[model samples]
Target: MRHEHEPKQRKHTVRNVILTVILVLLVSVGAYAARKYYNIKHAVDNTYQSAGIKKNRNANAVIQAKSPISILIMGTDTGALGRSYKGRTDTMMLITLNPKKDKTTITSIPRDTGVTIPGYESESPSKINAAYAFGSSGTAIKTVQEMLNVPIDFYAVMNMGGMEKVVNAVGGVTITPTLSFSYDGYTFTKGQSAKMNGKKALAYSRMRYSDPDGDYGRQTRQREVIMAIMSKAGSISSLLNKDFLDSVSSQMKTDLTFSDLSAIAQNYLGARKSVSQTHLQGTGQTVNGQSMELMAKSELQRVTNLNRKNLGLDHATTGNIALSVSDASSSSDSSVQSANVNAGN
Candidate 1:
């Protein structure tokens, strides 16, 4: 009986020691993960603006809600001019993502589109890009929401100066030239696909004058470059690179917090698998000697419908939505005047 009791005690002692070791390992791993999470959160919090946006129609929706969302992408020309974080939105795009439908629609707006900016001097109309330079994030978001007649849930202001570095960091991107032309020492033939480095990609996306479609063609190229970058960035190899993430983190200013981005990547990135690009149709005219794109009322309505449909708001009537394309003057009526702004880059 003594020998049997001794064996049982020894076995119990060994089991307790093993349980203790396992508990210690679990605690160590949990601590490491929490530390890493907080470190990333701190870095992203310091990178950009975290202020809550005002007047967002979908402000109630959380990232985990899986609801359809709209984002305004503004590409700024700030990094080169040695200016503050503000500058003209040289490229503007309104993107709608539906995770349920797994679809993404990106509509590129022309930079020179005449739109009234809030807080602008003299109450005169100006290019849509001016919204960023003069009004900052709040003003820019308001200006676009008024123009597109859609609730913009998020806005990202990207500095174009770091675009070259981002491209280089991702190795490079491949694009199919829509037309045969030579620019910035690189010769591209029509219908030929080419792999472009950072400098070449910038030049390719920037060359609008030589294309037959002018700004429209440039918009197409810009979309292509963006898709290419997105494609490369999603690769396993690119995700593993710490340096690439650091490079992009410093260049972007946005209202979306780090958790918001993480939730989007986790849930909605699959929508990127099928992407559709659209452009606003309008005629170019010189207003006060400055070139501006004048979109017709019918075209504006059509664009509004398309964006609304994509946002799962098609059944919701936007009959009250109208753009002041005909009048460059600021209106006294808040409803009529509130809708004035550029959807362009």
Candidate 2:
């Protein structure tokens, strides 16, 4: 009877050990899965093609290398319900990332600002936003380059739906109202801190009719949302979530490569924190029976000076190139004049 009892006790001990080992293995697997999920979640595909813009092969020659890279952040009204890819960019901002100074300058160009397209000649003075519809991203880049007299290094295009998804992914962003205004069935009170989700944030940035500053005020709100999004994105929680990355990538298109993103993530993450906002000073005028924002030559020169100085580019005079206009006979520039400047995070 004693021998039989001993055998049973040994058997029970053995069973306990086996169960413990299995539990440990399961825990290890879970940890690994979590790590992998985080890595992949923050990892985004490089969608930027370096074709039209000037390429700097020596961009990453050394640590703390000061390379001035310009990116076009485009927000399109495409991919929304009942919308298609043929939509033009509704918001565009030129972001100059200066890694050396750990500083960034964002220049907001009102979409209604008239500009000449580089390759086209039929239109002498056309709305700035028309460049995207006429020639896609490439043409838009060229048009901006001509308009601003600056080099564009990359382009990131985000659909309207993607903007909402990004806002939702970060939970939400807080925006301070500049003035009390209502449009698109939404009302924003002055001097209030509004917690905005994707839809409401979209409405917040899109409402321009009731704004006292008009497009400029709307653009300021857009920049506010952008800065809010960037702040949320920089958090460790966002960097570790794979679901958020997949959502953002699916909703947006870009020319930034994966390696470029990683380098930016590792090297220029500080620059995002130190950003200065810029707006082109312009006035509204009726051109060809349509209201347009006309940027004065002095205003353009000021933006060019600011962008060039921020990027550490060769300090050249802003009036070297002739302004080229896009062909307006094919498409009305008024349809494309909806571009506004917002945040680029």
lDDT of 1 by residue, 1-345 (tens): 011123433333322221111111111222234435554454456455742447567543744688888878777754642355466887787878788888766676777776666566343366677677666777777777777788888777667666687789888999888788888888888898999999899888778789988876775576567667756765444533446555555676667666666666567755554465666676776554456787777666666787888788854433222224455333333332333332222
**Model 2, total clashes:** 11
Q: How do the predictions measure up, each by TM-score?
A: 0.74, 0.72
Q: lDDT score, residue 115, model 1?
A: 69
Q: Relative to the true structure, how large is the alpha-carbon lDDT of every model?
A: 0.62, 0.59
Q: After superposition, how far is residue 275 of candidate 2 from its true place, in Å?
A: 2.9
Judging by TM-score against the true structure, name the best candidate. 1
